[model samples]
Target chain A: MVATGTWITQPVAFTSYQVTLGRIALVGLVALGLTAVILMGELDLSVASTLAVAGVVMASIDNLALGIIAALVVGLLIGAANAFLVVVVGINSFIATLGMLFLLRGLAFVISDEEPVRLSNIDAGISFGKPLIGEFTPRILLFIFTFIVMHLFLTRVRVGREFYAVGGNRQAARDAGIPVRRRIFTGFMISGLVAAGSGVINALERTAADPTAGSTVLLSSFAAAIVGGILLNGGRGSVFGTLLGATSLGILQVALTLSVVQVDVQNIIIGSVLFIAVISDPNSIRAVSGSVRSFLRGGSVLSKPSVDPKEATNNG
Target chain B: MTSEASGEATTTSEAAARTADLGDRGGADPDIKRRKLHVLEQMANRGIFFFTAALVLIAALFIDGFASLENITDVFHRAAPIGIVAVGMTFVVISANYLDLSVVAQVATAAVVLIGVSNNSNIPMAIGLALLIALAYGIVNGVAVGVFKANAVIVTLSTTFIGLGLLRWASGGSIYFGPSDGPIRSFGTTEIGPFPLSMIVLVVIAIGLHFLLNRTTFGFLLKSYGSNRNATRLAGVNTALVVVGAFLISALGSTIGGFVLAAFSNTAVSAMSSGFDFEALAAIIVGGTSVFGGKGSVLRTLLGVVFVSVLTNIMVLSGLGFGYQQMAIGALIAAAVSVDALARRAAGK
Candidate 1:
């Protein structure tokens, strides 16, 4: 950020930082939900589209509170529908969510009539959009609060621990008498609820609901979550890591914007970063570190260390 | 420990006994009932074929211009590129790595490369360069997935974005128009007695792929890898090679599809083939190809291609907007996948 500020004008850098931070706070909310679903060995590609739907719903409704409630309800319904297709109907989560992604995006387009819905009332918009403190928007504060609550919920709560078990191994979790299906169902619902919250925040921040708003959020949020150390395969990650990841991405975006890099180039950079992050994940890091240590100890890194079953069994 | 061992042994023996009983019942009164269920499952597996035939018949009976030879030919022409891509996708899916989302990006890249290169070079050189570019992209994906064991969806998805970005950057955000005087253009525009030349190319490619998949040892290894990678590896198959081959084949198909599409439209735009990967996937899934891998047929994908084409044609004829069309496709994808899941469940797979 200092480099960006130095490269560009300070005012422009500050504005870019503020805008990117605000935008990614909303994205961070979605990423938090995505982290949970991904940790549970499932994916919800429809989060972005669900956000679009919520945005549209919130934008279309006259009453602010009513719109917010409606959007949340719509999100929950979408989540339930996804759970039904995945858990009850037995469709693979990837395929089911992919379908939902398109379905919901299309629905958003239909609902919004392919136009951006602007929030007409300034007072209500200000309440949601204005910063609660200096340089900290309501959305950003909500994001931080949600992050803390979710962190506690996942780390401290019993059901949250069960989510780890289920994601780590569904059969094992089932054998252990966990309500695996219900846990998975709830994970998706939380994802849905968070997605809707982000959508509302987005609508408020922009003071309008654009039908195409969330199209790019899916990949960006995934990138953020993955960079934050969330495994795509499931069962390990944290909201705090995701918070840092989203912040880094926001900073990266701001930096790129200041650098005048084209959007396409920015996409390439993001894609590369995501690839690198996934490849250099914790397991990979451990393997590399072990091999390096072995090499330093004057042992051939490629040579397999002989293992005694007795020793292994005793350790276990 | 002793009790746990005994408990596991008993469960295994009981399972064995149950299988023995099932085998015995196969020749008894239950056999007929089982046979009926088997037949039902077969029908469900072939549901899309039946559905397509029924849809065509219904369209013929009801919709205007639906039964016309000209319109039918047009549908086939329109289906050709995606069908070709779907054929390749069938292999990738059957290999159990799931869908290749990069195909659309590959197609666009191929198209742009073909046009951009052909402008400065000969037609043959341009085509070769475009294919080489696509093959390189395939190698990158294959190595990352096959060698590094990266998640297929994430890797391919990242590649998709990267490919799109690189193509856009390279092209300077401009669309490329194919030159008028080449085999590529002729292939795109020419027809052979009521059929588009491109459709004929699609048929030839389909036949070739069917032979490769069903008649070759390589195909067997590919399917085996998809079914059980560990077992295949234990059986002395190079699983990485199989995976790489599948990705290459997928990229090859996308390249061809891109080339044909660009030629047909006489233009190469960065986003022209956006969402095509999903469309090919839909066709592949609709054709009864298991998304989980180890079971699928190119012929089934062919049927799926036609089915989707006819459905889209009918929808467009009915004057449905793009939004509704997207919704319908999504619903179709969900329905097709659900049917597959139901069939798999019924079959105890």
Candidate 2:
């Protein structure tokens, strides 16, 4: 998709493609955290809201270090609150985080007074986004470093692998003596921390914190995670996949801009692609095929319920 | 070990003796006590009612102009649109299909289509076309979620983008009804003996849906399906049809809401209903509908809508801005669901 869009632009500069990586890094930072939480069979819809809240905090403070620390602490508290709701209070992760999303979004608006907050140290903020080495800015380096560290955590760490175990089967994991709740709590905390970091980077790049900044990024991060093969069902996926997903999405956006495609049209394309990706699940595929076969065989089209792959395999 | 075993035996025997003592005293006394306990339990179960009542009392006492009849009517008028959409959302949530995030976009489509088509054609035709488009959206969403068994949240999210994008591209951003004096505008603003027409529509729809949910076979099947999908399917219920029906009702609600909103504003734009979907969902969840599904009522949703609208109204009257209102509502959703979860756990559900 990127190549085709770039091909139409006449001068297909590789440099433009490299520039797109910076945007991908922004998405990657958030998506990496999302990937971790999803691996634990939980969703964190509050990531974007937390990002906005953190960005607003970062923007309000005059000193860079203090601002970043305050932002991280805010993110950590929000994550801990989500953990208390989901892990301790036993609310569904999706609903709890969704509630947090709304609360944080509202808090962002309240703190910022529904207006954009410009960073006090404009030069420092701008420098963060400036390329330091061969098309890699400080923000991009942070994202890459976070991705690498997350990759190692999930792969090499014992506690990290237990997130998969907990998600795959909670009862069985408990029976096996895994600290399931603790793992989930840790996952959300890291997710919150990483999302805050992403917010800081975004504010640095833009030099302002807008109350509505994270609204669009919320869905985009999900798209990135899903497109990179992170199953919504959890107990599977990797940060590496999210990185690739973010990269492709960034490239697609860049390509569309290069080809002068309208924003609405771009949305249509992206939505359609997401729809296709969601339905392309193997379980959905089998269900579709089974229904088609039954229809062809003159059996009742809607009679047979869609067979759950996990259940079907278990039965077999 | 022996002492612990004897202690357990003693506890059981003492409990048995107490039961016998109660039986010996009188069945009537126990029955009255049990009845009182049952009433207390019922009240506890209806926690949302108390929460809403508390908010109303607080608002009435603290906020100026809150206790007035005009402000009360204004609250209902404000709630009408969300109530309409949330009534549909009740079914979707009860059926365990989760949220229809695309309703926001579907609403915009209806508004845009109504104005655009009305200007090009006739008003009635525009209404029909707008509803038809919404129905098409519902069908696509229903098939994806019901037939293909895709995740409801993601499927609806995708449809939101698709619907919004298509509407924006076709309408070229915004469209106007192009007339100041029309029947549609009157329909939006009309009042019958101090009651807004939209509020009446909401009430009628709510009553109709109450019956549909409590008295109909489809409602029974929908509830059962939500409670346990595999069990419902095993019982030969067309679970997919029930889900599709739920989505259809939701679509119908969105379309009607759009029509009302557009008529009131005399213009249609993609951003008009931006936060409406979440607002409706919040009302539904706040009204004591279990997010887990299989149990809810349109009546509860009605109270929820009223509660949310009243709270926002009170905030406005008290010099609070939209930001504070959003925060309060957001906090309410989390608190409501957390309380529900705790109650469910206590009940050992």
Candidate 3:
């Protein structure tokens, strides 16, 4: 906020902060779900599609409560379908979800007839965008509440800890009787439910549902989870870290907007940031620091260029 | 204590050997029941071949004008660009490098660059510059994945975004259309004796890649490395070179495909080749290439490309809507991958 204020005097008003915060909360809901799936060593590329489908479903229905229920149901079904393909059919998660991503996006397009649906008349009796306390909106509060609950679920629950074990080593987890398949299935379901919630929130906030709503969310959510220190390989990261990561991204977007960076350039910046974060993972960081320290001490960093043959054998 | 320790070591070694054998046979056994399953798995692995034959027969019998030589030629011509790109994807996946999501972005970038640069410069110069740009992206992807040991998926995806963004920014979000009455346009639009030039180019590239993958030392090293990177490294192969080579091949394929597409369309746009990466990958997977790497043939990818093209042609002839067509493609990919996985599992691999 301070940096943004310093950068642009004309736009540095209280409303800017409120808008930015609201945007963060909206995107953070998707990131929260993504963090769990990543922790369980799976990728859900269909989240954006799911969000679109749910949002469309909500916007199309006449009754607000019924619309919300229908959207959640759609989300659960999609999640189950993804889980069935990946877990039951033995398809790789990446391939299965990639397929689902296209399939659901197509479904959304079909259902909405490629038009944005307006929900201005639904009268849900709740204003998600309205400020609940000072500058904080109901959406932001809901996002914060979700973060705390997910953090507890992951850190304090036994079943949640199994997500880590399964992701870290599936065979070992299976051998340890951890019910690896069930954990994976459940993780995907949770992702679906959260994605649905995100869709509903978006519809409520904007009073509209667009078929393309979730398209940009996928990249941004992945960016947040990765920047939050969540390993793409899974079995690591925390909900709190993800929150912080999402907040940082929100701040970065504000700063960029203040600086009047082009939208396309912002994409390039985000991509570069994602690349940097992945390469600067803990293992790489350690290796780089060690090499630097050794170089400073007059030691050869490239002395043993060859990795041990034994290590190679294990990988194959 | 020593006896117990020796016993534990023997058990662990036995387990390791069992797992290794499982991987080798892809979960198959010589028992009668297992042999039956093996046969089924073989048939499933070649499912695209059978499906394509069936679809062609059905189309020839039922659909109007489907059996015409001209329509057949058109399908092959259209399949050429996708086949070209799939050839490189075949190499990448077989080398265990997995998917390159940036191929579509590379294609779009190449198309735009070719048209934009050719507006002022000669055709050959534009082609060279476009290829050079594609090669640069490939090199960066190679370095990130091979040298830095970054995840292939994420690295390629990031590059995809970067490429798309940079291209859009450079073009100022405007479309580019090159001169229509040039040698490049003729190369794209011309046909010789009922065969499109693009199809001939695809066939030539396919043959060359087939030879390179099946009859060379480099091909052997690539497959060996993909199957077991550690083992190949232990054997003193330059694994990094192989990685770089795979990505370069893929990029080159994308460049060629982009050039042909741009020439055929007579225009270039930032979003021209969007979502094409999935199609190329689907063709590779459908062709019976194991996603785990160390196995695949460019020839098979060609067949897969033909199969997808024919399927889309049929759909269009049937007047299926775009939405339904997308759904079918998605379902086909999921089904193909599932069958592959099931076959592998049934083989005990």
Candidate 4:
């Protein structure tokens, strides 16, 4: 909160807290979905783009009720498509999502004709863009709801455990009789749905759904997952970690921007952190370090029997 | 290294295939894999060139000014960054690790640091600080990748954001310091002859990288390290150092690229190299470098970058507009990546 006067600072602290709350509500829910996918050993760069498409679709609809349903349906369909390709069809998650990203972005550009879609709405004497009750807005509520739901799904549900197994080790998970395919599908779908929900919130806040909404968020999501101490290769990240990641990222950007640091430098810092974290991962380092020692000590070909089919001749 | 191992294993499999005494060996799994690989290898060797050439031809027919000397120079020059980036990635890929996505940000980080420091401080001190910061970044990534052994993609992706954000924050998220900055200007306006200085820089880096990859024990070890990382380790090589060194080299490439981009713009921006990763990566993959690592070439990457640059130039000149441009380029990337993936399968055979 950065307050020298503590809670006695009154209005200033209150505004800061409200702003933070507003940011979390807007970004946290989708980040939660992204956390799920990352936990399953994948990155979803297209989540932002997914949010854009779903929000645009919802905003474009005539009836609010039908629009909400349509958005969810579209999100599910897109998620399913991604899951089918990535989890089931075995396409690399990043590439598959990359394609989806371009496709969705292009579609957004086409539909919006490069214009932002403004959804007109207001309730209880407050505009959609403004905070309700000191930033305890509907978006904030949705964020909390999504977080609790995902936490439950991941921790309390059988399906969630299966998701972890698939990420931890596909072969072993299969060996243990896990329905790997379904878990993966669900993972991707969850990613899509939440991203879409994030998009809806984004649209509501701006009152104008941006076609490029998720175009830039790819970096943010990755930053969140990594800084939150979530491992990229799956089976090692947490939703809470993602929350922290998203929060820290938001704070860093805001703090830097507010301080006279230029915005671009902020980007560099985020990217650099991600890279460093990746390189310093323990398992990867051990594997690499162990290999170097082996290569030096015995000059024997290091072979993992489960994987290496070429070890015999490589030594020679 | 892994290629050698895989190559040897395949030969054995080939022998087994021959010994089986059935032409329908193609009917079975290994045989099918081999058959597929045979096709892929053929594509890797020559098909890549044809693909690039054909893309050039298609651009010429469809795009105006596409075949001009000006266009050719522009295309090649534009590709220089990716060419440089690919040279670094080729090492990492060959070493059986991941390519550095943070490279995209590294370019900007280096440029901004180099230009920013030079603009603000004494030249030597600025240069020293720039290099110091970049090396710190490299070590951070290297330690994580080499010491901690994280997946290259996530690590680099995270750093990409950090680096880009840092650059923007430092530079005010805008085109910075324009050509007035002398040291930064060299990265852009300098030239050895009719060629832009950036092109010459590309040539220098390419030659150096090629030498590093093709002629050195380090290169062989890198290849070995990637192909069968375990085998290389068991062979008692310091796989950690090698992998870390791979990141250092990749960062070096990004530094060079940053230098050149600084040269090109005479100013640095946060998004200067924003989309360079996919471009460099596309070139590497399109050049027939394996996404799974341990099989690709710089020459092919050069060609791949040239091909992409040429295609983009042609598309721009042709005036196909934005949507068509994106669609066509997207299609091309997918096609190239698909081909490269297919080639890996072929090489596997």
Candidate 5:
């Protein structure tokens, strides 16, 4: 019975292997740019909106080739704006991205005129976007390519190391001759650009540009990032973990969906998983020996503050 | 004219004396400094929006029926539901521990529970039952975050889904109400002395919240924990209990808002409040409750509720549709939160 239990519990034995892989590829690609900003210890709430706008921009261009190009350029511009606000204007990442969220959502609505815009022919929409190049889903291909390039850039490039430095401790990074402001700005830009790309992809998949679509995903993204073990304090997590977090969450949701569970139960289950992950020490022995090992290659640690609410009240 | 209206409202209060401290930079007699900080704090969090000075200016100048007593009552009436919700949010926001996003879900769910239980009879009992359920739901939210030590964001968010799902199931996947079309309809419409009874409920909630936030030990404890929990614990406070208790209060706020809606809307609909949680959050943040932790006020939230209502009313009157309103509100919340952060960094607080 114990042997059977272990066999059933092992993820390898789980029939959701395909779903997990698919989610990992899709969500990982989307989370990559966000990983850049998070590494610098900043939160970008506007990425989802950026993605939506980029998707809409792609739709307008019509030609698939141009659509993809338009999405990237628009994403870059938005990213630049996000960076400018956070690094130069000194707005906190949260507020800055939030502002960007409004601006982008507004632009989307105004341009779309509060109407859903789509390619009239479904095949035309997917012919360019959905084709698998000899077996690899385009999204999967894009995901792999993005992950590889991003991993290389983050590890091998001069600027990539700077991202780590700034995120490690902004003050220390500054002291070590990093252009802290510039790096931080660059991080926000990446956040916007990546989200834009992802949003555009989402549009292509659904064949519609929805201005309001991104808002619902914001908290989930945060939950994923946190569960993947990225620290709000910064400098302690990896893109790999974030990707893993997204995949794990996405797959878990799919698995729940396949079961007869109600939406509330699904939510309860996912919420529990996220909560446990957030509070549990990242490097508990079981966790270390578990799947987290394959992702980061190193280890994890997070300290908790000791206090009861009443004592905290009295002190304040 | 807006100033005159305020002057009329505050002829008897000391709040009138402290109104313009914003102009007095570097006036740091601790008392004055505290007062100025208080005003600025209110502005950053929620008060500025509620002030209606801006609303009055626009309405007085741009709107044809702006200053009419009828319009005044209408605006207050509109502000009532949001005010009640905001009153509860102020408690949660100030506790600096948890944020309750499940109110819309509660309201929707409770609306269904109340109406369904009424079984086409004893509507008041149904409304009362809904209030009881709202209270129970609040306890659930309180327990999930407080006892579990869960991240309030995820917990509340999921709770929202849970509430929404429960509502759908209870209603059998359809909205189960029609025109409150009866005496209960007046719960939302009845007015007294050029003022709305709904607004009266809002005002009472606001005053009650203010006293709870400022004039009590529990309030002080919440503020203290919000500022620094570790230090608070070291000082011997039961930080968890305080947070739990804070959630309980937030739940009560949710119940009041939900119960009122149950009485007024007379129908419980699925996905009826899909956007409500976000709007409440936007209002709370716009009112100036830091998403991070610590520092906010009921008065500011009151202002926020009014500001949002008037802003919506004006935008609708001006004929800009819901799309622009959303965009504008997003901008407003972002701007409000940003300015608050900017002030904090400047003040080194």
Candidate 6:
């Protein structure tokens, strides 16, 4: 889609292509973290709010290193808080994180006084995003680096593989001696940290931290994850798929922008795209198609589920 | 807060029964820890009432004007729309579908359809058409989640974007204002013996839904399904129908809320009902509706709605900004759910 767009938007230089990649890198960072959290059979709806708070906290600081450190710490704290709410308190993950989302968003507004916090040293902040090679700036490099590391971590590391086990069947995993709570904690914390990283990079790129900084992209991150095949039911999908999803979404976004598509129209398209992705889930496709088959045969539109609920429960 | 009136009947009857049960087991264990745990469990079970009482007393004492009948009625009037929405949410949550995130969009869409079409044509037909559209939205969600077995959260989230986007496109992202001195606007503010019409509508809906939830066969099947879907299915129930019914009820609530909200302001905008989704959920959860499903009551949810309204009203009276108010509500949700979880754990449930 991106290549097709580049072809139409004539004089698409290498730098322009890199700009698209740069955009992908930013969204990819957040999607990557989201994918990990979803993989653990839990969710962190607070990521965008965490990003906003982190960005504001970072921009409010004067020292360069300290500002970045402060932002990362803020992310970790929010992530830890989320972990505590879900793991220790035993509140449902989505609801707990939903509360966190509102709380952090309110915190951001309160601290920033409902205004954007400007970076004290614009020159220092701008340098952080400066291109290191052929328009591949530090931001892009960090995204790539993190992607490679996360890919290896999930695929190769023993503990990383355990995350899937934890998400797939938490009780069974616990019975199998996997540290379920720890894995869930790690998943949320990583998501928080990565979300903060995205926030910091965004702050540097924009040279200010708006209280509403990541609200717009929050849905997009979820879209990217869904498109990438990260199951919401958890314990499935890979980081690489999220990267592909993010990149494609990035290209589509640029294409839409170049074509002058209105924001509402773009939202419709994205919503439709998300719908298609969810509908295409293999399990649901089988169920829906089975119902269709039954309907065609003059049976009820929804045929009785083959497994008797009583028998299923008894077996369990 | 109608809870003051309703809470008395519910808390006393419920508490008396609970304490009677405790008396039956009286002095047997004599374990300090066990006795203390029992008291905490009782508190948790009846916590919403106690919480509301404490908040009301504190607010009445500390916040000037909070004790006034006018201010109290204003809070009830303010809670009516969201209370309606929360009543519908009660079904969805009890069924363990988690949430209907599309309520915000559903409300806006209904409002836009109601006022937009009414201005162009007539009010009665506009009401019918708006309800039809809302039902259609409900059906799509119902089929997707019930028949296809799709994740409820993701399906509703996508529908929210789609519904709102389509609404914005259709309405050109503009606010639809009803005629000045329109009958609908007057209906919104019409008072019957000091009770606003909207509040009266809410009470009627609540009473009807309360009976439906407790007395109807569908309601029984819904609770059974929510408590244990597979078990209900084994009992030869069509779980899909029950799930679809739940979503339809939710959409109906949103439609009525839309009518009340847009009528109150004489304007319909897509963003008018923003944050309603969470607010309704917050009320349900605080009302002691288990997030796990199969355990809730419509009357209890009403109390939850009033509790939230009074809290917000007190915050406004104290001159707190919107940010702080949001934070307080957010914290309340987390704390409420956590307390419920802890109490359940203690009771060995």
Q: How well does candidate 1 score on lDDT at residue B251? A: 87
Candidate 5 residues B1-349, lDDT tens each?
5665544333212331232232122111245344345444555633463454555566666675555556666767656766777767766777664357677777576656655666566767876776666656656655555444545655666667656656665566666664546565667667885567777787677666666666566677777778787687557554555666676566666656665666656666666555455466566676556655666666656656656776777777788876687777777766676677666665667
Each model's lDDT comes to: 0.78, 0.78, 0.77, 0.65, 0.64, 0.80
TM-score of each: 0.87, 0.89, 0.87, 0.78, 0.80, 0.89
| Model 3: DockQ score | 0.33
Displacement of the residue B61 alpha carbon in candidate 6, Å: 1.7
Give the per-residue lDDT of model 6 (tens digit) for A1-316.
3235335543433336777788788888999998889998788889989999999999888897899999999999899999999999888898899889888888888888889999998986788778888768988999999999899989999888998898788899999999898888889999999999999999988899998888767777887888888877788989988987887777776667667888888888777767777767777888788766755766532224322321221122
**What docking grade does candidate 1 earn?**
acceptable
Candidate 3 lDDT by residue in tens digits, B233-320: 6565656667776787888888888988888788899988876887888888777777778877777777678678777788878877
Report per-candidate DockQ.
0.28, 0.34, 0.33, 0.30, 0.23, 0.37
How well does model 5 score by local distance difference test?
A: 0.64
Model 4 Cα lDDT, one tens digit per residue, A140-197: 7778788888888888999986777888898899999998778888888898888887
Q: Which candidate is the best by DockQ?
A: 6
lDDT of 1 by residue, B3-27 (tens): 5433433432343244334322321
Q: State the lDDT of candidate 4 residue by residue for B91-208, as single tens digits.
A: 6766655467788778887777766776666557755665566666667677676667676666676766666666666566666575474655655665543356677677666656
True contacts kept of each: 0.45, 0.50, 0.42, 0.40, 0.28, 0.47
lDDT of 2 by residue, A1-316 (tens): 3334335532533449566877688877899998889888788999989999999999999998999999999988888899999999998888888788888899999999999999999998888878888878998889889988999999899998898888788889999999988998899999999999888888988999888887767777888888888777777788877887787777777777677888898888778767877777666778678756755767443343332321221122
User: In terms of lDDT, which candidate is strongest?
Assistant: 6
Candidate 1, backbone clash total = 0
lDDT of 2 by residue, B45-147 (tens): 4655666667776776667677665666577667887888898778888888778999999888887777778878889899888777867877888888877
lDDT of 5 by residue, A25-52 (tens): 6456557788888888787767777877
What's the residue-level lDDT of A308 in candidate 1? Answer: 23
Error of 1 at A81 (Å): 1.3
- Kindly list the per-residue Cα lDDT of model 3 for residues A1-316, writing each as its tens digit: 2234234533543347876687678778899988788998788889998999999999899888899999999988888889998899888788789888878887887888888899956455256667789878878888988898888889899998888888788899999999888888888888998999899888887888888888778777887888888877787888877887777777667667767989889889878877777777776566456545645777433223322321221122
DockQ of 4: 0.30
